[model samples]
Target: METASAESVRKHVRVYVTVFVALMALTLITVTISTLHLQPAAAIIVALCIAALKASLVAAYFMHLISEKKLIYAALTLTVVLFLVLMVLPVSHFADRGL
Candidate 1:
């Protein structure tokens, strides 16, 4: 039992370290993207995509959401849907104004 527990802890630690490394790599990519001087719209899109991935990593492992129940996933889906709607609202409004 102790061996099993120790193995589980090591596995969890490994996952955490991997996630940390991935997050750091993503941060570096973000910095590199910024230096590319992309157009504002393209840069925003790229940045948002990277940000979403980073957020997912944090939510899944750091927040222990990967092992959560269906109800939790449903709620998270709802939140994402609402967030996307909120994000689009401004863009749509600007489009309507010909901006």
Candidate 2:
């Protein structure tokens, strides 16, 4: 088993604190945006964008995925690509409709 030094521990703590602060800020911003009287479509898109960003932050930091191996990163990338494809499929319903 390898042992890390005090400095390394402190660094990890600092990163964790930063991540926490960022997550809190994102949460606050999302809440504030939701309260605004945006058009339905715009509000939905904006909320989805914020949700995606928050998910990324949680996955990267809270999940410790930022320190993961290359294979994990590849998997994460693929997952995001698939997610995007799925997200766009619902838009086809609006294509034939008159705005």
Candidate 3:
């Protein structure tokens, strides 16, 4: 039993360290992308993609969402859907501006 506990701790520490390293690497990649001076749209897209990935890592590991229950997933899904709707509304309205 004692060995099991120690092993669990070691595994958790390794996961945490890996997450930290990944987050740092993503941050460095973002900085590198900015310094590369890519076209505005491409840069924006790349940055947003990286930001989303980083956010997911933080949410999954740090927030303990990876082992979350179904209710949490349902709520997060609803939130994301609502957010997308909100984002699309402005774009759709803009498309009708010239009508």
lDDT of 3 by residue, 1-99 (tens): 124477777777788899999999999999988999999999999999999999999999878787778898999999999999999998899889964
* lDDT of candidates 1 onward, in order: 0.90, 0.81, 0.89
Question: Which residue pairs clash within candidate 1?
Answer: none
The lDDT-based order of candidates, best leading, equals 1, 3, 2
Ten residues in a row with the worst lDDT in model 2?
1-10
**Model 2 misplaced regions, further than 4 Å:** 1-6, 93-99
Model 1 segments beyond 4 Å from truth?
Answer: 1-6
**Model 2 reaches what TM-score against the true structure?**
0.70
Candidate 3 segments whose C-alpha is farther than 4 A from its true place: 1-9
N/CA/C clash count, model 1: 0
- How accurate locally is residue 31 in candidate 2, as Cα lDDT from 0 to 100? 90
Each candidate's TM vs. the true structure?
0.81, 0.70, 0.84
Top-lDDT structure, candidate number: 1
Q: What pairs collide in candidate 2?
A: none
> lDDT score, residue 87, model 2?
76
